[model samples]
Target: MEYDPTLPWYRRLHWQVLSAMILGLGVGWAFGLPAANAIGWIGELFMKLLRMIIVPLVLTSIVSGVASVGGGRAIGRLFGKTMGYYVLSSMLAALTGLLMVNLIRPGQNADMGAAAQQEVPELSTPDSAVDLILDIVPNNFFAAASAGDMLAIIFFCIVFGAAITGLPEKPRVVVTDIFNAFFQAMMALTSGIIKFLPIGVFALITKMVGETGFDRFAALAKYFATIGSGLTIHLFITMPLLLIVLGRIKPLVHFANLREPLLTAFSTSSSGATLPVTIKTLREKVGVSNKVSSFVLPMGATVNMDGTAIFECAGALFIAQVLGVDLTIGQQAIVVLTALLASIGAAAVPSAGVVVIFIVLNAIGLGDNPEAITIVGAMLAIDRPLDMYRTAVNVFSDSCGAAIIARSEGEEGVDTEVRH
Candidate 1:
């Protein structure tokens, strides 16, 4: 809510990352492969730092988030409706990305000789739906955590945290506090790592451009277009349809009411930071009651990230396409599921979806590939603006959920309690 408009532009994170990327491009273009090979290690090291934080960060953030959900029939129905909307919306958003990527085929015929350095390696798609299911519930939690298997960790933590909610008050409080503190600690650690994003972006871009000579960047433009189109469909077509059919609210009025929060979300690029404005707009201008707005908006901000979901699914598939790896139907399904789960974990970090795209790539068996990080770093270089757009879609989806749920609950004047 508070911003210092007078601050110098270069002092901002996005601008700094932009400057680094431009510098990387110049150095690589002028000096060529030698420059790329020299600085590539720094970028790889930055990515390694990211992988280092994943296990603890995923474990703590998810469990602590789910632990906040209370148990009882008093709010059970409301909880179910709220969660159903979040889950369904997020799935549709991701599926939109999946559809667009396959149709556009943005990564087709991309020249990666320098980047791939060999024949296109076969994609490591998921074996079967049954195997994927089995993989989700690991035999040993600690073993899964140690192996850095995110799917198993996410499943166990969700179930574990839900069970904690059903526990007696005293024990629940004790356990919840521990995870909460640990989650904060991990976030602080992540914040520190995110600070080096410019360095990482610079190294990755310099290496890729140095080797491949900007051909991939052409594909990157198409890739960016693919994501943008998917997000636009989900934002304009899908969300407005939900508003009309589900909430019975006029899309025009709702958009008008949300003008302030959407702009704030776009500028800040953070749903968490824009929460105060989102809630106030939904409750005051859009005409939802306090009870509905308070409960739904907070949880939605945490777990209901529709825009990020689309980005994750599309990003993983685009990476596969770029490396000429064909993802199987089951593997695509895995991308969808991973995107959903990663959206929940994404809430705790600075560059939420950008960081989690690595997780989606890893789930689809591409994490170990050194080349994957190169493209990811390129994506990071252009991420700030993309992040802004998706984040607005995210906040807008949350408001729509609150409005629809309030209407379904038989609350009068839903989206009509006040007019801006």
Candidate 2:
């Protein structure tokens, strides 16, 4: 937690990460896919290490956080606010994407029919909404944790953590202390892993740039522009406004503190993979308390997917445009509703959005079209970069939720003072 005052800025973590990104971009551009593929293992190792800690970190953090609050009412209040914020933010994000895609018309007048010749990636559609609700209660808690089923883990932790509050005082104190200790230990472990972040970012970004090069982007120029512009606006303009206005926080200061996690999220392109870093940064750097961060952040990873919602709505509309199918207003409303629900259930992994996007397509009557399949196949070619952008947005939104919720809970320092 301490820094050497004498160390030059160039040796600092933020500067190091920035330098890694620049160097990675240069190397990837010069060497291309072979270099990217060769060096990818370094990034993968970092991701593995991050993922290794997530389940335990989430379990202990949520348990400890809820127990520390000492009652179900406090935890319930937090949950209500957190979920309300997520729904509102997701609606805005999806609406923004819907509006942007309509204005840009990326698929209008395009000859993307040849996409039919490409093979579509196999994807498993999520079960019915009721089934998704049922799945939140795992058949076995240990199995859910081992499989890293976030929603199931969250449900179990909330129940277990709440139960701890109702125990006799002596046992409640004992149990709470144990979970708190475990959470702290996990944070310490995460801090050690975070030291390798710059190297991991360098490798991951290099591989991404090298493998997909710039030429492919030109082919999907308008599609990329629409999604990219929408994401940028949502992340930089919309979220910051929400923080400053609603949360009473300094958006720039919070953003400065978030650089490490955001970079890691972009590189890994999986919020679940980056959850440890996100929780660590929010608590250590952004000055959010463990109570708020532990509860808000883990839940955010599972359901507060502003970026995925945006991508889902826009991507569905894009495919429709390419196929020359105009959806009615009622149908677009279905896209919005389905996108929100689909994003909540979407796996927090790179390109996972594409897999569930078919739900939106199917809802709008385009799911069975060969032309729709063709466009999806074509879109897959450039999904990685877009995935990275949206993942960063996803992480950023989660952090914002934590900070806001912390402030609402009367936790100070985040809105009034800068941590770093």
TM-score of each: 0.60, 0.96
Instruction: Report residue 187 deviation for candidate 2 (angstroms).
Output: 0.7
Q: Which pairs in model 2 have colliding backbones? A: none
Model 1 clash number:
0
In model 1, what is the error at residue 211, expressed in angstroms? 24
Candidate 2's residue-wise lDDT over 132-208, tens digit each?
A: 88889999999999888899999999999999999999999999999999999999999999899899999988988
Which pairs clash inside model 1? none
lDDT by residue (10-102, candidate 1, tens digit) is 765556666776897899899889998999889778656766776676567657756775554535676789889999999999899999999
Model 2 residue runs over 4 Å out of place are 1-6, 113-120, 123-125
- Superposed Cα deviation of residue 105, candidate 2 (Å): 0.6
Q: In candidate 2, where is summed lDDT lowest over 10 consecutive residues?
A: 111-120
Q: How well does candidate 2 match the true structure in TM-score terms?
A: 0.96
